[model samples]
Target: MKSTGFTLETLKAKVQALTRPERFVHILRVAELAQAIAEANGLDAQRAYLAALLHDAARDLPEEELLRLAPPENDVERSHPLAVHGRAARRLAEAWGVTDAEVLDAIEGHVYGVTPDNRIGMAVYVADVSEPGRGVNAEIRELALAGRLEEAYRQAIVSKVTYLKGKGVPVHPRTLLAYDAVLA
Candidate 1:
């Protein structure tokens, strides 16, 4: 459980520099949500906050650049540019001197079609979906927040799968398996 030296100021600065004002606000919301989840789940609140803050550090990049840096194989289609942000975030975390293996791993798997095995990963995964103010239907988000975390995770995965399918995008085996591993 290595920890990064990312203080509140440093984390805020890093996000503000990388994300637009609106996006930074989203990050703030996610951070607060992560901290809340961490506290409720008896995990490290600060670490969870950092991981959520940096989760989208590079989410605004062009799809071409994202594909060039970390190409997802057939098992993981490159249909979503948002997926590439995880790779960019990894690079940003390293450059920012983030040494926490848990934090780095969480950020890396945040959108890499992988299920988180650690507490930190699980926390960020939930926080990413349950962040306040997302444009997702209010009822769905409320249902996700109103029950046990495992139940919420299951719903989130189903929501993600349904959304991707509706978009006519290829669903990655890892994503499906990851969700199943937690939900089932």
Candidate 2:
């Protein structure tokens, strides 16, 4: 479990303490899915699992605390403060001794959107949305497992946007940018 002075068990304990039981289960599922996607795509499965495990580390924090940890970067993030968990997660991961830049970047971008250049980040992002517990799209999970990462990620984002629109919620700009980047 020890890797570069960080223990997987230690990180899991920290995550369990930070999240509720349900959220902790969700985190584990995301990690599992991320690992599968990473392995299928020839990426680092361990890094992907670590990133997914820590991606929601700060999600249940108080709104004030999340804002304090990482100030919102845009109007959407400011209005929906929970979205900033991704950004705040980077700090938590770093404090937990997760020094890999790829892992941190994946955790930081999992909630909002990852840059196209970060394959690990993309895997984490896709896995978070398509995790089985979400009970939404099954095709995204299939695409990810099949190694069609970009396609899976695009479908996940599109499904999210569509759902938001149906709910009369404004889509976050970062998501739109992510969708565009994937297609470009």
User: Candidate 2 clashing pairs?
Assistant: none
Q: How high a TM-score does candidate 2 get?
A: 0.93
RMSD of each: 2.8, 1.9
- lDDT per residue as tens, model 2, 1-184: 2336678898899989989999999999999999999999999898899999999999999999999999988888888898889889899888778788878888988876777778899899999988999996678989989989988888887787788889988778888888778768
Tally clashes: model 2.
Answer: 0
The prediction achieving the highest lDDT against the true structure is 2
lDDT string, candidate 1, 17-119, tens digits: 8788888888888788777777766788888888888888888766776666557665454555566677678777877778888888788776733463566
Write down the lDDT of every candidate, Cα atoms only: 0.71, 0.87
lDDT of 1: 0.71
Off by over 4 Å in 2: 1-3
Residue pairs with clashing backbones, model 1: none
Off by over 4 Å in 1: 4-6, 75-79, 112-116, 137-147
